[model samples]
Target: MTDYKLTEYSHKAGCGCKIAPADLEKILSQRSGTSFKELLVGNNSNDDAAVWDLGTGMSVINTVDFFMPIVNDAYDFGRIASANAISDIYAMGGKPIFANALLGWPMETLPLELAGKVMDGARKICEDAGIPIAGGHSIDSKEPLFGLTVTGLVRTENLKRNNTPEIGDVLILTKQLGTGILGTAIKRKAAKEEHAKAAIDSMCKLNSVGAALSQITEVHALTDVTGFGLLGHLMELCSNQVSAEIVWSQVPSFPFLDEYLALNIMPDNTTRNWNSHELKVDGLIDLKAFQVLNDPQTSGGLLISVAPSKVNEVMALLNADGLNHAAIIGAILPKQSKTVLIK
Candidate 1:
């Protein structure tokens, strides 16, 4: 067994062991009276990255993401986690400029060598993204934890917003769904090496492709799917004037995911997300049908909304560059009372 530091054990890791959904709801609801500022992108909309206008030509994009070891390999885990965090920058049509490490290590249980591997993995990803690791802070805890606080630069003209999904837009998702379910399976030893490897590769893949998306003026809005899952993120895109229809069959999914679901290995968050949006999705489709679709993602792909006429060109660009998993998943429609529909 490993050795690690001791802390007052209320929870195992930082943010990984998030407070229960019910508790979080109650807490957030109690603070609904807070006011918003012109430049502040507050929690009200569940935005992926916060934007701060610096001045004339540029803006600052800030986001922080952290989680526990979804896989056992320290180096691989760090690479995936760092990629996941940096994805937010690209999702918002920004270039990551620098990153600061966020870590919680069990100094008494886990060896420093393992922690070093984690940083090494993160460093490699930073190198790939053309970003720098400026500096960071760490804590001693009962469980190993790792992630990054990334800052990116966005020109005023290039920034993407999650709330700007337009009615004439088409939806595209860059990678397959089911990482969360597959990850749960791995933790339970119910998945094979191939399945685990697929999930790892997807999680470690960067969103530099999304930067190309910014050049397409018709690409209206974007966000990266992670902990909350696709349905959760889609609900945030819905507005009184615009809604979305998801072609469930067109969505890319993992190879053995159907088999895993057949074996009942879906993660609990999948259902939690559905229940949270049950009101918005009531008659749009059978809620019971999507336990696999709504599964939480770890470093998932960009979910972009582009002008319907531009879909082919976008797909062609992604394909020519070897982004084989990229596909047009749905279209934005004139808003209906239901907000979202799955066909």
Candidate 2:
């Protein structure tokens, strides 16, 4: 057996390698010539995945996600990446039927055996999700990458979206934040054992609960927090005629984040995320809160907006399902020119 440090070969870790929001918008904006009426959810909405209305009470959801390794262990990286990819389906309140793997490997630098380990890890997660890896594509690259293109089914009425939050709806975050900060610290060899374990556990956990919540009528909007961080994704939910009020104290986060923030060990994506919409954000956002808000997450958690009356029920369900870190973080509010208000 050979010891391999996967994160060393990559310049950026996990979702932090995503294109900047501004750059992504610019690229997406260039494609203005196409439109499809059957597409219930498309690039126009910034939703998690593209959903095609089957017109028979069911919709098909498709999403693809890939990223560089955030951890040294090939198995952990594969598990995290696979969970992150399928999360888009769950975010839309869909059940994954199957998936196809996407692999990018540095064949000249790394052995094929490590790639097999990655595939094995992905297969395990798929099995946990009760889906199969039908097939996939691979490519020779400079850095290792693994993910999935998942196909899922959702009842038309059960579909959830990011942009339809009703006012007075309470926000729920399923997992604790701070993966990006911890990943950065880990890369720098500054993270503690406890912090690393917490991050890895959170990253590998699936957001399948989002699918269950989708069946609840009170659950209005849903989104999985990923490389964009909680605030970035919440902003998506607040886009257009909606705004959000986030209670700083109520937000759930990893316990060791204060130590990492003090050391100024944060991911580079934090700034990029903030720069993308800082002007649209109101309220007091200080240095520490800024880092926490914009810190990218790998397979983070689902941010759910449920009716205030059902908040307790939703929280209880999440807790009963072993998602104890779930917390009522904020509420949707009427638009006030700003998309998000942190207090």
Estimate TM-scores for all models: 0.90, 0.98
Give the clashing residue pairs of candidate 2, or none: none
lDDT values, one for every candidate: 0.78, 0.90
At residue 75, what lDDT does model 1 achieve?
A: 84
Per-model RMSD to reference: 3.5, 1.1
| lDDT over C-alpha atoms for residue 8 of model 1 | 26
Per-residue lDDT tens digits for candidate 1, residues 1-343, read 3532212222322222343344567778854665634355656656778887777778888999888877777888789889999999998888999999998888876778888989999999999999989999999977777889999988878888777888878999988888888777766668799988988888888988777888889989988877667877787776437888888878888867777777888766777766777677633454334765667888988898999888988888777756689988888888877777888
Candidate 2 residue-wise lDDT, 220-295, digit = tens: 9999999888888987898869899998888899987989889889999999998988888987547877888889
Each model's total of backbone clashes: 6, 0
Alpha-carbon RMSD, candidate 2: 1.1
